[model samples]
Target: MPRSILSWSDRSLAAQFALAGGVVMVLSMLLIGRVVAARIEESVVRNSALATSQYMDSIISPLSQDIAEADTLPPGARRALDEIFTNTPLGERVASFKLWKPGGLVVEATDKTIVGRRFEVTDSLARAFAGEVRAEFQNLSDEEDRGEHALGLPLLEIYSPVREVWSGEVIGVAEFYEVATGLERDLAEATRNSWISVALVFVAIGGVLFLIVLRGSRTIDRQRAALTRQLGELEALSTRNTALRERVQQAAARASAANDRALRRIGADLHDGPAQLLSFAALRLDALRGQLAETGEIDAVERAVKDAIREVRGISKGLGHPDIEDRGPCEIVTGVAETHEARTGTKVAVICDLPEGLALSQAEKLCLYRFAQEGLNNAWRYGGGRGQEIRLDCRDGRLGLWVRDAGPGFPPEDAERHEAEDYSGIGLAGLRDRVESLGGSLTAGNRADGAGAEIGMELDLRGA
Candidate 1:
């Protein structure tokens, strides 16, 4: 389809409708004008034929046989013919006339030079000879008829058969050229009236159609505008949502880093204040036992003091992250994976693709270590630990840590079970909070290969 000048996108509905209506109106006017003009011309020719035929009969019926075929009229009859045509009121109405024989000869005419002249039989002449009257408005394109148009006036050409009054036999044909000035006026008036009527009807119909289309167009335009406005609002909302999500992730990351720092401080305080005191007490108990070998409670006191020191040391180890701030990211990730493997007996495969001397903040390194530690521990405990792999990759200013295990995967069917279990799902949630707080994301699910489960974390470290 061709594109519209007033396309739907570019123009309002009302304008489009108006343009279409205008085209239809113009086409209708042209069609109606042609029909009206054709009808008016036909009516004028038909009426002129009837009027001219009757008048010719009054003059020619009296001598139909006197001028039969090829100017065979006697001297007196010819004189009578000339007198009736030239010296009467009817003569003023007629421009010319001819009596034609069946053999295509002009039997008699007002132009005496044409008398007995043979002319080609025209369709109208042939029809008249066949006992039918024919009439037309002529431009005189015919060679024989051209001389008659020298007056520069339109003519009503009529062909009427001169019939016998008694037997109704068509004996000859009479061709009449009547002055069409008055007929032309009547036709003009009729044509003007028809055009006016058509125009009025066109206006009334087009107006009604335009009004209906305009209303619908306006409704459509309103809907489109409202939709556009709604779309704009939705786009703005989406942008804000993205910004809020980023801010939320950053806040979560900062919170996790703060929490880690607090725990590290607590661990240091416990080790320095409580663990040191326990160790000193254990040493004092050893001396007291030697001093009081007779007392039975010395061994019990020594064992209790040693046990308290051990527990304090264990608590401190659990609270602290790691002392690998000066190390590269690769060293930090590998250390966490190795440590987890040693503690859990779950052999982890570590793949490091980090660039050498990559700079990162302490919190970022801690976040990476924590993620690796949590991911490896979860894989061992929950994944059945058939096979384990840890991957650390840095590319395009983003760091990714992935831990996967070839064990029972996390499936949708096990979701409720995991949620109900304290250690199963809760640990992952804490890990997520920690990762998110550091402006990163964490995800845990079945591996793409369907053979294991995978837990991954991604952090943006462009400014690290």
Candidate 2:
């Protein structure tokens, strides 16, 4: 019930059982010992009383015969009782004696002052009148027992019935008190032995149970300690793995940014060197067309050079990412969509619902730019540029982008096939990897309406 006791109990199963079982064993031993001691004393007292009553009846029954016909004993019977007390060997053992008639009248007594005095009828007196004997040891609370109380000796009080000689009818009661110092000593020894035996048995049983519980408690404690150590090791390993994962993510992001910068540099090189050379060759062919005799060949050569220049410029444009470091998410998305529309000559619907002040890292912005570029390019190529839409918004602390087109969606096998194949181009697989590097996800599938294909990406802005 107290905090300290609760803590002790929590220490182990054996300690708890010891505390509870010890209390139960002690109480059980005490109860059993008390009952056994009481029964032993009662048995000893009753046997002694029965033997004394039988002997006393042989001597006093004839002397008390006058009580069957009269309430008072005659003088001769009274003198016989007095001589038995004064001169007989039985007098040395017995402390007091009485003869009674019906209605609680004491016809004769060793204490002569009580002769012919009436008292309340007790249960023992009633049972004796009905032909039963009753006895008690050292119980001197009765009014008639005052003299015996003063004697201060352990006494056995007995009530025995007196019978009429001719009719064998119980007509009166004889009550006596016998000294019981020997019986009291025997009872005291027996009680002590009984208590000791009960206590020993209880202790033995409790010890056996406690030993069994202690064995089990020790096993459990060992197992618990082992489990605790294992759990601590697992926690340490988990912390190390988490730190490694963060490092990997940061490396991926940095690599993506560096790759974007490299592509931008390549784009500038193509536009400035090869593209300019192809444009100058096409101009020289146009000027030399008028002087050539075969104008058809000259015109065809000029057209091929101009077409190569256009292809190189397109490759350069596609390789470069727009400047988006200074822009918010909404502006970046809108700028990419507008650029896609301008280059492809296809109408792309743009919807921006991004929150105010939405911030993004440089790597994240590059990823977003590439995502929009690839998504719209796929829509225009596969969907014939019909119903192309780019949706961007921030919801529930996450930033999301979706590009949808009214076209037959990707087949189920397309995703599996893409994963198994290797490609150097910037495609959906590449975009997926870039998104994942920044702790985002990309999914390309059919729209829920079943009328179009959709490419969606979601980024948790909390980390950003």
Candidate 3:
């Protein structure tokens, strides 16, 4: 299982370039160091070769003087020259000399037996005979074999013109061998110096780079923290916006309900209070009319007075005013039936099946009373002016107020269905608004049980 990085900036680039750079730097230090050391070795070898050449020149000068001073052909003098030439060292870095006649013939050599051979023979000898310093490296073809024995080995050969002391004529060729112990020593010294320098350089670069990375990391952390705080603020603002919208919706619903309740209360006041006062005054005027007939004191004035009181009572009832809330819904329904009995000579059946002291709110009680008043008024005024009966019931969690008549029920589409002026019990529309808001239902039409008209309402026990 791999662990996740807990922070953003702790990761380092572990890649090929870093590894390669380390490897290359080490290898380069080794190689360049070797080159520097070898140069030192070559310099020492060159110095030794030059010193050896000078020593060989001293020996050659004395031998040539002794040979030139021999005026007669003497065997002893020849024997001495041969001994001196044969005494040369065979080690590397020693000069190997060759003498040539003016006609390009080899007369003497550092190799005593091969002396007197023609100078125009092998390629190296032919080049030397032409007065050129025929220098070469590695007798064979290996690159590391460079700068070794060097005659026919790794060597840098210098050919100086050797002349006879008296005649000043060209004589032999001199070749010096270069060796490379100095090159190896110098390369080792260079390797040590370069390693220290490269290490110090890398340390300085790494330190600077690390500091820059550290500062950058701190700046990024600060930015991230600030952004997180801003995000938190934005989230809080969003929550406040949502709460404000909810409060606004609640306020709108409450305002609409308040307007409906106010209209209902106004209607109830007109129907129950003012309307009944006017109606009672009209009944007194009819009594006054009887008295006027007996006294004959301005009969026209008494008739006009009664007419005016009746009109005022009609106006109040149309505005939904009446004295009805004083009694219980059961008593109101039964009394309206008694009025129907008196005015149209009809009977009404009313039943009360509610729990004792079954209380109700002001709006619900008013609605029940208004419904009963209109039912009785409809029976007295329009049920053939005579013979109809209404049945009312209260039962199991409901007040079932209904009225029925034997007179012709109006059509379902009658203009009086919800007309306030026609029905007048604080208006059918007002009854519906109150009952339904309390989770009850009201309906008006012909009775489902019979052919006469019926109007009934139901109230939920809990809601009422």
Candidate 4:
């Protein structure tokens, strides 16, 4: 009927340990009590048998002589037996007695009617005839033992062998029934005392162990709570790191967009302010030359003003980007390549192998345009102004731009040094930043043929 310890809901470690310890302690105590009681009973029975056998042997020698031949003992021996049995220290403790011959015949007894009766040889009687003394606490419930049963009390039955003095042969068996009230009371008390002592020892040991377990349980609980708190903190920190990374990406995109806007503004300013003013100055110089017809200084000034106007206009045109938001990938690439070819007056081979109507965001389009523009310019200035190849392709969910020129490639060491110095001139580094801000990657190296410099940019367009 006991509940299982594991079945307990939300039970603490200390409680579980106590429950298990208590169960083991109780089981151990039960086994100890059984063993102690058995040993006590054995000792008590041996002592009782030895005492009863000695007292009966001394007084029953005469009765045994006449027991087999006669139904009753001789009167003289009978009177002596009667006097000893009723009026002695042995008689006070012994409740009843019986004498048996070899064939289960009751030859003489304290109960007169049973003197001539024959009963079956019991296990105890058989053992006695075989020269053994047997003693046990018995209930006296057998039919042959009805006389003793009538006493209505517990008895210690001792079966003693009556042997011949000279031959050392067992002649008859004597059954002695002793009142067991005092013995039972003593045994019960001893058992109670033993159980109490053992239980106290077990409980004391269990108590000490439980206290140690309880203390350890408290420490474990505290550690568990602390670890849970630390785990929560780590999760929160991870979430914050993710948010911070997202914010950094957003900021980089905004910065790239700001740079493009500034370039357009600077280009507009150059064209509207500096280029217009220079053109007006060139026109006035021409007019002064017309008025001072043969002045050589006037002619040099007019030509200088005209050259300045052209240079300023070229600078403005180079800085501005064509609006290409509504255009697809091919149109955007073609526009950038053509503008570069026109301004530099160099041959640029354009190759476009993209899916029809490839959609790109406005920022992504600007990034590609800037990449192509910078790459071609670098190729012209540093790549011997030779054959240049501009390629735009979208395949396998990626958009790519590759620019190559048949010129000496940029050395890896030189590239590393430039990057460390944060080089931005000629717009190679700036182009890389704009592409990267749009979640793209750019690489510059020699072409696979090892004959020319190459700049390549790739963007993941799966999200788009």
Candidate 5:
């Protein structure tokens, strides 16, 4: 989650990416620098060697031609060889040059004292005497060599024979020595140029790399801040959700308590007021009947009293005056089934296989009673008072309730649209909400017989 180059010291993705890029940049620039440096060194070496070789070629032909006529005039020939080395085309082009006789005696050298002494550089002289030219390199043989002017690196030497042209007689040889100073100069210049190029390349690449690092750092910081903000928001949201759940629970409890109190008062009021008023009216009607025993008014009073008593009974049934709140959920459920059977004038069957003594919270009991009550009402209204069935059972510590009627179920589209419409009485939506509020589920569907609608609800009892 930490998105930065520094954060990637331990295999982070951002660090990995940046590291790979820097490595590639460094490698590519270094490789290019090395290739350019090598080429520059090669060119320097080639030019220096070419110039030295060309100067040697120019002096060689003239020295060989002049020396051929020398042995006959021995007096001036050695001096002539001396002049050949000192005044050659590139003055002092050969740091040291020598001429030797076929038997390896030094015929001539620029140093006059060693003209006749056997040359210490015998191998190089012998190579020339054998009629072959050879080039070589070595350290400056003296201890005084140092710095650019000194031949410290190595020497380049070319050795070749000078001979008699007409008779082919082996006479002498010439050996050229170019000390290491000359080669070192060319090499140093090449190194300097190479370093300059390296500096420029390093500067450009380093600038780009640093800029890339800067941009990447900024990006990582932004992402880190964003993630932190999101986490804070999520924590706040979770807290709010928990508080809302608690508030809902408290509201439901208060509502249930209030409903319970209202139900008891209503039950008391119906039993006291309506029952007494109807009883008083019946006694007065009996007294009037006796008083007018022989008159037609007596018959009329008898009919009016009978009508008032029947009306009161009807009002009580609709109000669910006694059965609604006077009993437990189980009794209330059983009583509704019996009332439906009697009032609908249809065959209403009830199959109650519930275990006895099932306990429920007040909220849970109210939801169960209301759901069953509305289901029966819907079945009676829609089924046109035809056959109805009700079922309730308890097993595995859970309860299941069902109500059915022998009539076509509501059209699927109409049910979906009108299910929310609650003009009066408890509709299907209210019943469903009631069931769900108590942590139970209710569903409606066509009965298995393919001719009716069935409503089912299930609830956990002890688990509720």
Candidate 6:
């Protein structure tokens, strides 16, 4: 109901239960104790009244036989009542006595003023006339009880039926007040005991429930703490994994760049050293051809030298890296195709469907160039450069490149073996590594239409 109470209750499961259950237990105990005390007091008063009424009935029933026919008790009966009250031990215990005819008429009473008086018929008096005994303790509210009230002590007021001796029919009612100091003391003791027992039982139950709640609350708290610790550990591990992955990707990019630089150096070395030596040998052989008598050997030697120079130059040209850093994805791919066509004298079909202003990282650009270069070279060498097609496009934020040829595809078994082979040159396997370094993948297989073989590479632009 209040913020402070709610906050306190939320402190723990046990506290919550204690706050709510304690209130219920206390209210229940009070209600049950009050009811038990009331029942005990009522039982004690009724029993005391029954005993007093029975003893008085024994003495008065015989004297009051004339009351069955007459409205008032005769003088003789009245005198007996006076004698019993004045001279007997019963008078010491009883505070006052009265005899009533039906319809609220008091025919006789120890107090002479209330005799022959008519008062309102009370519930107890009516019950007594109907042949039942009713009793109340210390209740002096009736007009007839004014004298008893003046006595100023606890009194058990009793209304008992008087029956005709022969017929057992109720004819008159006897109402009396008995001094009940002992009963009052007994009721007080009983009420005290009842309240104590109820309180003790409720407390015990509350304590047991609290213990259960406390045990469960402790268990849950432990589990929650453990789970929190575990979650923290998992989060830390995840962060470490993310950092490691980024490091790996950076290493791969650096490696790819280093490999490209090495290839360019090797191409430069071949072109500057071996091509010059082979060209000089060819020129010297041509000069010596005229001096030889049998010119066939000289011609063969010169042709061989020329072929060696041509091959070395071609290899150097293929190995040399192109200046593609400033170009977009479409221009890079188209340039590679055009270069391949000019070198091999073969026409290449170039399909560029990339979005305008497409961008890529340096690593990705290098990977794409090498992929197209290697793919077209393979087509020329293995497939006679027939029906060569380079397809490029950007789809769903990923850049795709495909080089296809109208030649027999790789055999399934050889293709699988080739994927696992170590590639030292700028071949399919090495190209695969370069692509994968930029978070891209390369796949070599037959075209879906069965018209050619296709080598495809895809890179995620977002990751780049």
- Each candidate: RMSD: 7.6, 6.8, 23.2, 10.8, 12.6, 9.1
In TM-score terms, candidate 5 sits at 0.43
The pairs that clash in candidate 6 are none
Which digits, one per residue and each the tens of the lDDT, describe model 2 over residues 34-122? 99999998888888878988888888899888888788888898888888988668888888998888899999999989988999998
Cα deviation at 254, candidate 3, in Å, is 12
Lowest lDDT sum, 10 consecutive residues, model 4, at 416-425
Using TM-score, rank the candidates from best to worst: 2, 1, 6, 4, 5, 3
lDDT of 4 by residue, 102-199 (tens): 88888767898878888888887898899988887865766788888887888998888887676678878888888888888887887888788888
The TM-scores of all predictions, comma-separated, are: 0.61, 0.62, 0.34, 0.52, 0.43, 0.54
Prediction 2 global C-alpha lDDT: 0.84
Winner on lDDT between 1 and 5 is 1
* Best TM-score among the predictions, by candidate number: 2
Superposition error at 135 for model 6 (Å): 0.9
TM-score of 2: 0.62
Candidate 2 segments exceeding 4 Å error: 1-3, 6-13, 65-69, 100-103, 127-131, 163-170, 249-464
Q: List the residue pairs that clash in candidate 5.
A: 138-155
Q: C-alpha displacement of 362 in model 3, angstroms? A: 2.7
lDDT of 4 at 255: 88
lDDT of each: 0.78, 0.84, 0.54, 0.80, 0.63, 0.84
Model 5, residue 288: C-alpha shift (Å): 13
Candidate no. 1 TM-score: 0.61
Candidate 1 runs further than 4 Å off: 1-20, 54-84, 98-134, 160-174, 209-249, 260-376, 387-404, 410-413, 416-426, 431-450, 454-464
